[model samples]
Target: MAESPPLPPLAVDIDGTLTDDRRRLDHRVPSLLRKWADAAPVVVATGKALPYPVALCEFLGIPTTVVAENGGAAYVERTDELRFVGDRRAAEAVAEEYAAAGHSLGWGEVDLPNRWRETELAVSREQPLEPLEGIAARHGLEVVDTGFAYHVKSPDVDKAKGLTAVADALGIEVESFAAIGDSANDVGMLERARISYAVANADEAAREAADHVTDGTYGDGFIEAAERIRAGVD
Candidate 1:
């Protein structure tokens, strides 16, 4: 008899899903990922900047591409190649306007990896997103709140689009991957994956979009999803 087909790749969001907090990754994540990487490829799809995801891929020793800037850029770790597709001019213009108008917008509680980004402008999540939303709408831009940071980008850029780019580069179908996420920016990829999971800590929108909600939070939830994927338990 023929052997069963191989499992598809695993795509994960960086913040809130893979890490316990902004500064910490789950201790169990590396080992579990080592096992999973042997079975299938792993991709980091996030709203983070290029360096952060690229560094993560390096640390994991996973030869995978990273989707950064909330889909604004895709970086191939092995080749050290970076591609930028997100249009941030309009967003930048709007941000400047808001700043000039006396909004206290700046990088949030954590250090911003994309503070010097060219494809997107991110501000602290502490600010009201409503005004930015209205401003973005008028300028044909999209404002995405990732819980930790608010990303202003083109409407065409999103996590799903980033996943599609990675899948294309790997010669795989988007439906062949499983996705894990925990925020509004993750919604598109979550809905696009063959199977999607949201951590227990996810917000309502993400939880609602996911195929399953893991009982654990943060890294634990991610491990739970990975195990279930290995088990083929759906």
Candidate 2:
């Protein structure tokens, strides 16, 4: 087997890396993550909102910090404390731009305004490119084409920034970290790590950017990556 990189702090993306297509966490992946957590701090950096990944961490019984809302927020699950990092002013500006271009913004919690835990915006599926461009230009937000949904978020609020914050808090250098992900949003976290992995089902862009591609999908892919890290095989 090829020699794997040294054990380092692990930062993983949630949606496609930790959860299966059904959005369920694999039974095996949690054990592997627990093993790594015992060795070093394991952080979950994702674009999901707080409650989503926080529940996952609780289930895994790992001491994990979460980056949610595409980097708009960070939270320490054990403490129930949160940090808001994204530039809201910039986000508002982008929303205005989208409005001017005749595109409406849809929130993940559009129906439950008071209960919405975080701010997430989706460009109107009916909107034309002009509005999309305006939205992107105004807030300096990136337009993520997810096919089913177009995610618009502040450029600074991303998985990479979340991982960086975790590293800083832990006093670990960037070279001593590994990241695994499977989406365009995961790109930031992947790029920040000393080692990066993409799952078999990863999108083309993600696969192209990854240093290594796992053979499996979802939680199985994470298990594969963890085994490689444990066996010292890259």
Q: Compute the lDDT of residue 198 as modeled in candidate 1.
A: 96
Model 2: number of clashes? 2
Using all chains and alpha carbons, the TM-scores for the candidates as numbered come to: 0.91, 0.80
Q: lDDT for every model?
A: 0.82, 0.71
- Model 1: lDDT of residue 182: 94
Clashing pairs in 2: 4-232, 4-233
lDDT of 2 by residue, 70-139 (tens): 6666776445567777555665677676666655565443533213435555554455656675567656
RMSD of 1: 2.6
lDDT of 2: 0.71
Instruction: List the RMSD of every prediction in angstroms.
Output: 2.6, 3.8
lDDT value for model 1: 0.82
Model 2: lowest-lDDT 10 consecutive positions: 108-117
